[model samples]
Target: MISFKKQLLLSMIYTFILVLLFQSTALSCTTLIVTPGATIDGSMLVAHSDDNHLIDQRIIYVPAMDHQEGELRPVYCSAAAIDEFPQYASFFYPRINATDRGPGYNTPGFPQSIPLGYIPQVAHTYAYFDGSYGIMNENQLMFGECTDGAKVQLDPKPEKLIFYSSELSRVALERCKTAREAVELMGKLIDEYGYYGTGETLPVADPKEAWVMEMAPSPDETGGLWVAKKVPDGEIFVAANQFRIREIDPDDPDILFSSNLFEIAEKHGWWKAADGHLDWLKTVSLGEYNHPYYSLRRVWRLFSMVAPSREFSPWVEDGFTRDYPFSIQPDQKLSVRDVMMLMRDHYEGTEFDLTKGIAAGPFGNPSRCYGPNDGQGDVGNPNRELLGAWERPISVFYCGYSTICQGKADLPDPIGGILWVGLDKPSETLFIPFFAGVQSLPLSFSQVDTAQFSRDSAWWAFNFVSNWANLNYKAMRADIALMQDKYELKMLELLPVVQKTALEIYQSNPDLAREYLTNYSTQNAEFLVKEWWNFADQLIVRYDDGMFSEPKKMAQQVGYPQEWLDLTDWSQGPITYKKRN
Candidate 1:
């Protein structure tokens, strides 16, 4: 028999534990969802920035698998996955085998026998494609996710068997074919196995359709509750580490969700029938409103860029009542170039522009260095003082990897999907296209360790060049941009030719088509890396110590902005008439 005091003490301890768990697993990421009609080429586009606090940003490729009926599969989690399940160590190795060889069947085994351990296995698995740290199975079913914290109690408690978000994504990518299928598959999995990580918003897209699904674990700790809304054909939607889905329409064929989404919310007292339709964002959100300066500002910035006519204030004080629609009709149809440029936006020409102030330093660099608790503190807590911190822009410098994924319905799946990946900040790195059907990834794109600087790694190569340009950003950015535009334009121009050739070959021999694409992807990636290395050398020589080094050209001197000079309280007066005594 337990005493009343003992019971009370245990309850308090459990509450404290939940609080700690929620704080540790908080994450920030950005995603952009565009429907077919919003795009110039009638291709659905989904862009994601996997931003974290200094995690390795290597591109992981999981080859399609064909597994036997009874074979067991191992599930591993990312380093951040440990926060939600502290009992489990971070699985450092690749979750799926890079090669096709399974465990027991190596070298034509003497007898097919199961290993002496209990391992979980799915009933069956399918072939799929993955790129830019996200999954896009061979079916051209692509998926990307952003993390947004939910109610603290909804977080997975300690020592529970659950699936991390990344693991769930990998499984769905491997198993499902379309956006709707992936959403339903993930929902089913979460219901049975339970979701273990922080809240997440996944933008799942196929060649013909796109859906943004917001998910968070239920407060009952049984499983996750989710709601997915389809992006209308002619609309565009963006999410920046925040829930964007508003009302629910269960009867709508476009909107698919967990069966118990509203039931669980009502059970937790987060929803009411009188609220009319179940509001996923309002019901599941961690309840930080009135802090537009936090995550909401990024949403505002994106809306302002795409639909300037539809006014959205970054300074909105109300939290749940934000008038920003779930999706908006863009001012004009967008191209791949327009979407890529949007990924590189930093609120230029707006009041929240990170580049115009003294924080940008003398070179007009929009990048700002973030410390622990710098921008995230005010997200779910509006009372926290901002202290005039620089706005969190889309093209941040510390992103591990960013991708612009395109799914086109007009062409064959192999020839349609393209993953335009940038190694670092989109503004600094070139988006080299990797076709979906490529048989092999470029060596330069694989096995990157961000901690060590290696010339062979594409990520390091671009980072080296971008870091050098940052030194004399104001002076050197124009040259870099020129090179960027030239190379990217060349790739774009060559795409049609490559696609036509590949399509003709695919009609004859799909294998031959894949081989052609593999060679093309590898060649372009290797060439881009080689060119970036040369560009880095040129930048060093041209902007050496802030002076031009061309033999025939005079050195170009640059000065601080007059506003900056005035703010420093320094004099621009001529040298004193009399020498200082």
Candidate 2:
């Protein structure tokens, strides 16, 4: 028979496990938007950080294709899709190897081809020159997404149709040439087949314009309800796991949405004609507005960074009163580097800075290894009860990958678009430029093994350096940032020359231009990987343990911060040892 004490302990353990399971379902991602006029180089920019803990992400290159008439394209669901929509038995089929099948339907890591549905194929699919989590086609069109879950009753109904946000983004990239066209196509597809993902925000951009669209599953489980708002030139927008759109102007040309957007809400009793005007966010949001810490804090952090002069408080008793605009015009034009820096924000110098307190450890690292208390609560000790709150900074260490895509109208499509990509934590990794005309991806950028270390893999290399720096961040970050600046600045400096040369080659032969751009991208990636390895070796030797090793001199001790020392109880700490004679 078990003791009473054992029974109590078992009960507590079971409760913690339940809490962890609940928190794991929360979606986390951030997307930043910039209009062409808001950027210094006249490029529309949209950046995203895929902060999901599962990190097997790698760069994928999908070449353009031309199909004959009477051809049909099969749609397959990924492991993520299956996990997200378990009710759809089709997505849960046995995994198949891409090696066993032919081309045109497979994606890297998503080898399992469980045919979910089929869509009509276009006559000609543009080249997948540059791409990220979503898609970017040869015409300088790109899409980025952030999950903003809707009300519980609005969970996807798999029986109607099956196109998740990712698949929709993919199809749009293949079929559409402009931002408006993509938006129209997406609306048509979602309306006809239905949308099957959680609430999502997609920023679709071309060389000339960009639009922010928010879509949610229909309450009646029939289809999707959505609204797309165009970001005017010289303005910026951002979304971080929460709906940002407030009201809609149905007749406005800049606003595009489903015909049943308001009808569905009214039919389901989610809204009423007596409510005056339809507010999409108020009606469709998952009701997370009352919880500031989970989502609103991120929105506040982003707004504060882009427009510091504006008074935005991270903490407020009620979020409804906080009238933060959907988009804002910056005081000055932003640069590509500025967007990259914004992706690396950690709420520094703000009241919510995670690195400033005792929770940051003695080394002052801004990052936390995992979610609060591993999503568990303590019942045995009241003092140990899980707070379950951590600052959701843009540049967290566990991010799978992050991307900044630039679409410039002034240049040719091949020379205009640039996808700046980084693996792991954005703060620790360098953003390498991948032009839209590049033909092939480097081997280092295509590594798939996330479970084990590989010296040849770029993701592993950056993770290695980042993990080490987290050990003594305050002391070692200077060295890491110095190297980061060196590589990033050099890449920025070479951009103009690269574009000019590619244009010159394109004037005579376009194929030659593609080859040159591809070679330049591959070579630059290889060089960056080699440099990171060298820097890793130097870091290992320079900061081993708690000492700083000099090249030709004795090592120096690096101690903890004075504030950390002061917080410790050290009344009997000074232990004196007798020196040996």
Clashes of each: 4, 0
Which segments of candidate 1 are over 4 A away from where they belong? 1-26, 81-87, 91-133, 153-160, 287-291, 372-375, 378-386, 554-556, 572-574, 577-581
- 278-354 in candidate 2: lDDT tens per residue? 88877786434213455677777777777878867776665443456788888778999998888887888888787
Model 1 lDDT per residue over 1-581, tens place: 99755753564466346434433223456788888999888988888876652454556555656667777655544434433222232312222222232331121211222211223566555544443235575667887777775773333333343565676777787777788888888788777767765567889999888988877777777777888888888998888767888878778777878888888888889897887888888888854422344567777888888898887767765666566788899999998888888887788888877777887777788887654444335245656665445577787776666788888887887789888888877778899888888766776776565645888889887888778877867677788778879988889899989999999999999989988988999888998899998888887878786777777875666566687787674673556786544
User: Of the candidates shown, which would achieve the greatest TM-score relative to the real structure?
Assistant: 2
Can you tell me which runs of candidate 2 are displaced by over 4 Å? 1-26, 78-111, 129-132, 153-159, 289-291, 371-386, 574-581
- Weakest 10 consecutive residues of candidate 1 by summed lDDT: 109-118
TM-score to native of every candidate shown: 0.86, 0.88
Which residue pairs clash in candidate 2?
none
